[model samples]
Target: MTQESQAAEANASGNDNLLLQAAAPLLNAVVQLRQAVTHDDPAGLRQSLIDEIRQFEQRCKQAGLPFEMIIGARYCLCSALDEAAAQTPWGTRGVWSGNGMLVTFHNESWGGEKFFQLLSRISQSPNQHLWLLEVVHYCLLLGYEGRYRGSDSGRVQCDAIRKRLAKLIEETRQPQSESARPLVEVHPLVSSISRPMIPLWACATVAALLACLLYSALNWRLGNDAEPLLRAIYQTPLPQITVGRRPSSPQALLDLRQRLNDVIAAGQLEVSDGAFGSKVIIPADKLFAEQGTAINPVGRALLARVATAMKNVKGTVLVSVFTDNRPVDNSRFASSYEFSFARARAVTQLLQSQLADGHAIRSEGRGDSDPLLPNDSNENRTRNRRVEITLFAAPETLSNHQGTQ
Candidate 1:
């Protein structure tokens, strides 16, 4: 052989070696991607798939082969991965079109025999479109057989495989001479392969940014100044009511009760002797009636607890305060219900201050209408001059209709 022929052979061998080396990584990436998908790691799988596509494209470029073939392979692999991840059982014996456009697989009873029968029909067909379909069919059958049985026994099988491969190679080759337009348009393939990754990355970035923003907002809202309020809310002072019968799944009710207890405990709210057992009593003087004192420590503590309890509690917690009528100078009751209502409204305002979101509080006072005992005695009157908290079940609950009192 001439020196030129030896150099050409050496270059060809080098090119072949490069192609093989490039293909190894590309093939390994595909396998890793499949494994990632099987393990249910979508992020890992997506990244691996993207890397495989990039590597395959790069290798195809280096080998002087049309990247369209690699693109077609990527498309098929992606389709298969998607189907597998979705748990769709794809049959082994089938025909997949050149562009992975359509797939026809052998169902039960239709095996190699049926595949050969279809091939015979295609061979007899006159139409070019039918002939192409036949070629696709044979190619798919060859792939299927290779994948499953690992055999190529039939006389026509080897020929079919060669023809199908040749056809793909021919389609991939760029025209020697340029016409009005480019022979092979690869821009679409590049765009089609890369377009999905952009959106995936963008969505991931947006989600991460949103998560950070939400965390920051929460931290800022619950800073140092809110500690006293939160503490007062969490440990309220209240008498424990060990009701003989409690609901089977009283988690929601218990949470509310605990929060109220925390507030009562922290505030050290004292109850005046009389009324049904020991109920909390707020002195009218230290209440909202005093211009400077919007809410006493006890009242503030109670309000904080109410706010926290209501956070998880679904229903409305009605709070009402009543004032003493027997005072010699009863100027505060000149407006009667209105003065009492103002006190309730003031408590609601304190509760609102502790809440994160702007929530409306429903409150009303009926003067001394629903007194627990007669106002004849000082002790009985003290009981009447107090705030009452009633927890009504949510409107949506079926048991809410039952009378609690």
Candidate 2:
């Protein structure tokens, strides 16, 4: 066979296997349900029905089928069967739905006949035929209404069963043996009949005894001293607090900033000075266009710090990076400063991709307009060719700050 034909056959075989596996549980449920009903125990039948439904649901999941549909089908079937069982011989000829069952006993156009005609065909002895009929009724209900009405139908069937049970109880009478029992039996006498009630407070004695017992129980369960000694053995220590001092001076800020910068620098990211601040720039052509060049250690480290800073920063901030500017590079930027902006944008994209909430970050690139220095000397030009980041107050912050100002 051709390769494509072989692959198709393999896929079909796999599907068949899955179906076979799923069928086992469903079959087991059906068997259990049958056994429960055969025993004539309503409680057992109900439990078995629940188990069967649960098994069917599990099978659906295993077969990668929609579990809800299976459940719906079961519900519809059960409801229909219940409705059929509850109806009198005359009431059996009807269609059932969420609203109610419709009975059509005699209608010339619709082959007018009492619905009891169907139930009358089944033999009353052994109850198996009735049980089988119930199952068939459920199946018919499922076929007519589909899975959508299963849940409602199932609930209705359960309610009908409960009603039937109540009616059964009302119709039942106690057996002769049970009803003929004596009202009370006399105990063997101990011979002495002495009554001693000298105190007038004897009536209140019972109330006092009950109050004492109640108080003791309350103290045992809720009183602090009555707490179990085992609990004290597993007690944990109180948590410790470590307060951090805030950086005040520009030097302190610079020191902390340097420490953070060192982590990014260690990663070996491309760095440059910009109009506002020193920045880490990612080479877009190397990182994006050509995926071969992996993000260097420096880029990863910088990304990490940027992610950390993002969490604490109350206002919206933009991170921009720059790459080497080429005159022939008609993408966007012409100068090094413009290239720096692109680099910053690349870094911003990287950060956003890494962080789950990165969509909240606002990012942009300014080609070469804002430069660190005059692009005259090579050294100055290199310094100018850099990414820039600025913190802009969030709208809420801006409004609050403006109000305060």
Question: What are the Cα lDDT values of the candidates?
Answer: 0.41, 0.37
Q: Give the distance in Å from residue 265's predicted Cα in candidate 1 to where it truly belongs.
A: 5.7
Displacement of residue 272 (Cα, Å) in model 2 is: 14
Q: Please write out the lDDT profile of model 2 over residues 1-405, one tens digit for every residue.
A: 433343234234323233223333333333233233223444444445456555654555554543323322333334443343323232222322111211110001110011122222322221323222333232332222222223435445435533553333223322323564332222433578575775758757966999898866743333222112112211222223232222223222122245456655654334433322234443343233421124556556656665564443344445644333223143332233333434554565666665553124434333334455666676665554444444433445334444554
Poorest lDDT segment (10 consecutive residues) of candidate 1: 98-107
TM per candidate comes to 0.30, 0.26
Off by over 4 Å in 2: 1-261, 264-297, 322-342, 355-359, 393-405
Query: What value does the lDDT take at residue 256 in candidate 1?
Result: 47
Q: How accurate is candidate 2 locally (lDDT)?
A: 0.37
Candidate 1 on 1-405: residue-level lDDT in tens?
A: 433343234234323233333444433333333333235344454456556655655655555543323333333333333332333122121221111111111011112222333333333332322213322332342233321232334335545554664454344333421433322222323434334455777888988999898866743433323333222322333323222222344433434444456544654444222211123344455454442225677556555655665564444445667655442233333333445656776765675576554233445544555566888888787667776554433533315422331
Q: Which candidate is the best by lDDT?
A: 1
203, model 1: CA deviation in Å?
A: 75
RMSD of each: 29.6, 32.8
